[model samples]
Target: MMERVHVLVVAAGRGSRAGEGLPKQYRVLAGRPVLARTLEAFVDRDDVAGVATVIHADDRALYDGAAAGLAGRDRLAAPVTGGATRQDSVRAGLDALAARGAEPDDIVLIHDGARPFAMAELVARAIAAAARFGAAVPGCAVFDTVKAVDASGRITGTPDRSGLRAVQTPQSFRFGLIREAHGRAVAEGRHDLTDDAAVAEFAGHAVTVFEGDPANTKITTSSDLQAAELRLQTALLDVRTGQGFDVHSFVEGDHVWLGGVKIPHTRKLSGHSDADVVLHALTDALLATIGDGDIGSHFPPSDMQWKGASSDRFLRHAVERVRARGGVIANINATIVCEAPRIGPHREAMQKRIAEIAGIGPDRVGITAGTSERMGFTGREEGIVAWGLATVRLPVTAD
Candidate 1:
């Protein structure tokens, strides 16, 4: 039997050094919260079975808002309130997992919530090393000369640079070993340990090191955050625009669904799905942006699985495809062409629904309604039409 893999994300630090009024982990990085991105790195992986986050007792509301848009919230344990120090927080998180029935043999990766750039390949290496040696951490080879400095900033003896490695997080270890190490440290009044690897070493466990990515940086200051943003900008140099148009004919019904919003109408739109014209168009637009064919290519009308399905599922799938390609949906602008149902009262709700489905802020989603000058099917109240324009930012890859 394979042991389960769990993750502990320590995020209780005040992060005063980051120069942010809010906790640095809760600060916005790129477009989403920093902690959300960190959680996503683990949440999207199939190898990760569960995740637990340790946060300060006073930061419940902040944590809630930061994690509101993440899809992996269901995989998270009810967040454990952390202690005064990072070590204490990790212990608290481990305790929470144990209480939730984590076995002694299970593997746990302790990661920093501020380090959002950890890649899946790095995590895989850490897990492999831990499984082989019971303790491991990802580290990068030091490239610059090392010099020791005294308290007065005087130069001391230089250490051998060839033997130095800059260690990173998602430090993996067996559950029993790390728990015992943490318990021993508390019993011995040793609270000055800097990282989990140090704790294991103090407990007499030999830890192995695996190769780490240079981009897996911890955000400690404002300059670091700016640099991360610049890196993201460089990677996302390819911007593309896609347009989609959808039309649905009228049917005998009391209401109609548009952009996931149900409005009372004299008639309804007819299709295999809920016939949400707005969402259908937006989904197609997103698919086109990613060059993933159209909505019909994914959910065919001939397939009974999508019969009377909610169009929101299609929209969500499109967004997931964008993320799978290391791209972000910059904006979605949709226009509803109808003459009967007054879209004015429900425009805000429509935008909010689109944002939720796209995993972005509502401000980035735009919705408007207009008519076809009483000339087309929409003007005649025979059907509704929707036009969508999607702007996407995708990572540039070498062709």
Candidate 2:
């Protein structure tokens, strides 16, 4: 049987260089958190037995928010609090694994939480190299010219690029061996070592190298984050737009629900559900973008289970369906045609409610309200009508 490998992700750094907002690991890449994507890369692998993360003492809330939906996964361990340095943070992660009964000779791969693009093939290579050589790191061939400069800013020497390599993580090692190397380094006051390989060499252990992918770039600056965003957009090249429209007649009530928000009105819309025309139309539009069945097909009006249900549930279900197909909702726009309630006063509230339900920003959800100039049922104040448009991005897959 193949041995299961443990993964340790270090995310304790403040990321001061990445800018002034949240830490780089907690920053949004595309739509999801960077650390969330990194954790997904390891959690989705069957070969990974467990995953642990080291975080700053004050980042528990941030980590929890980043890992919100993944908290239930059995293989994800509770985060460990890290110390001042990167080496200290790595040791904290390793010890957390040990406390959970990791064996002495088991393989452990330490990775950076900011590097979200490390693929499965690279991880497989790291695992094989660690099993064979006991200590291994993934390294890419240096493609640019190498220059050694002095502190005085004078040109020193140009080295051969052919022999140089740019090392990246998932730096793999035997669990017990790396732990002992770290302990020895601490005991001898060797706190200046930068990486785990240096600690291994200090303990007289030979480390080998495996092929690394250039796409496994770490996000350290604003430019890197922008590049990652472009890469994600390019990967999801299949863009689709879908439209939906729904109308509901007026009923005797003091309030009406639109776009998951309740507004004071002379009468409520009449339908099988809460009669939220905006949510129903938006849900249908989102489903259409993913080629899923319409809202009526998923939640039939004839079904007693959907009677008087909140329309937000329908929209949330459509969002889940889009995600299941590996699709991202680029934006949603809706126009409500009603003369009675006056939609301008509640436009921002409607947009925020829909954004919350769809897991997107309010800026991505647009809501506009206008009347039919006394021509249609909406202008006659008899009912409400909504037209919805959804733009989605999906990966191009084999048919």
Q: What local distance difference test score does each model get?
A: 0.89, 0.88
Candidate 2, residue 272: lDDT:
98
Query: How many clashing residue pairs appear in each of the predictions shown?
Result: 0, 0
Candidate 2, 61: how far from true, in Å? 3.0
Q: Which candidate is the best by TM-score?
A: 1
Task: Supply the global lDDT for candidate 1.
Answer: 0.89
After superposition on all CA atoms, how large is the RMSD of candidate 1? 3.0
**Model 1: per-residue Cα lDDT over 37-153, one tens digit each:** 888888767788888899999998767655654555567677889999999999999999999988888899999999999998898888888888899999999989989999999
Q: lDDT tens digits, residues 1-399, model 2?
A: 687699999999999989889999988877767887788778757899989999999999778766643322478889999989998998888888999999988999999999999988999999999889999999999988988989997879998998888999989998999999998998999888888988899989998878999999999997889899999999888999999899999989999999888999888889999999999999999999988989999999999999999998888888767866667778999999988788888889998788767766568899988889998777789998999999989989988
lDDT of 1 at 369: 86
